[model samples]
Target: MTSRHHNLQHLKNQAYQDPLTGLPNRRSLGDYLQTALDRLHRHAGQAVVMFCDLNRFKEMNDTYGHTVGDRLLVAITKRLQAALRPDDVLVRFAGDEFVVVLEQCGSRQQALAMAHRLKKQVGSTLHVDTAVLQPRISIGIAMTSDPLTAAADLLHQADLAMYRAKRQKGDSVEIYDPVLDD
Candidate 1:
């Protein structure tokens, strides 16, 4: 490829990727989710936005220092990516938080199933460098029928559900239910 083409590709990579995890950043999540929503609208499918957070990484950072924490983040990212379908979109939202876009789930149960898988994968402990770290992810899920629902709103709903999960004792995944909106 031409140097100019390479440079542009590099730039796009930087724009879409998280500096730490090398996963797609939230900058790309909006566009991807919007496109998925549009496709769902056309084909009569369902789309879900999942808010993911790695629990207790801050405590790890405090005990092990930032460098280990960074390595742990990368390892955690690897586990998350490995747990997902090849076509799924994963984003590093901040610190240890991630967002996943799941396409074409027929019902909230199906979406919840994916969420359960994610919770299981992320909740498992993995060895990072010299330290053995167990990181659990709390998930928030939002399902939409219409393309018109704002992307930010969908994310917000998922985030709220994730927070709800966090409030429960262990690794948890909660779907956005309007009644639970808080």
Candidate 2:
């Protein structure tokens, strides 16, 4: 490839990737969701957005140094990637918060099953330099077959659902409902 083409590709990757975890960033998520929405308009499939937040992450960071926190984040990212399918998109949305886009998911049940698997994977114990940490995560899932749905709106629904899950016991999963939006 030409040097100019290589440079452009590198810049594009840096723009869309999270520097810390090496996962896709929010911008990449937006682009992927837009493409998925367009495909759904012509196809018959469901998309699910899963918003995940680590429980007591701040405390973990406070107790352990920032280096340890960073290590934990990288570890969690690897586990998440391992648990997901090749077509699934996982992005590090923000500190201790990640989003997974399940493209062409068959149904709500299938999405929930995916969420449970992620939660189980994250709940596993981690050994960070003799500090055995058991991390818990709360997940909110929003699935839609609606072609008109905007990516931001879908993400908002998932975010709201995630808050609801966090309000309950940690490591819980909640599906988006219209009532939750109210």
* Cα error, candidate 2, residue 97 (Å): 0.5
Task: Report the lDDT tens digits of candidate 2 across residue range 1-182.
Answer: 69999999899989999999999998788987777777788888898899999999899999998988999999999999989999899999999999998888888889989999998998889999767899999999988898789999999999999999999887899999999967
Residue-level lDDT tens digits of model 1 in 1-182: 69999999999999989988888888888888887788776777678899988888789889888999999888878877887887678889888889988767688888888888887776666776677887888889998988888888889899989998999954788888897764
RMSD of 1: 1.7
Separately for all candidates shown, the number of backbone clashes (residues 3 or more apart, or on different chains) is 0, 0
Write down the TM-score of every candidate.
0.92, 0.94
lDDT of 2 at 17: 94
Scored by lDDT, the top model is 2
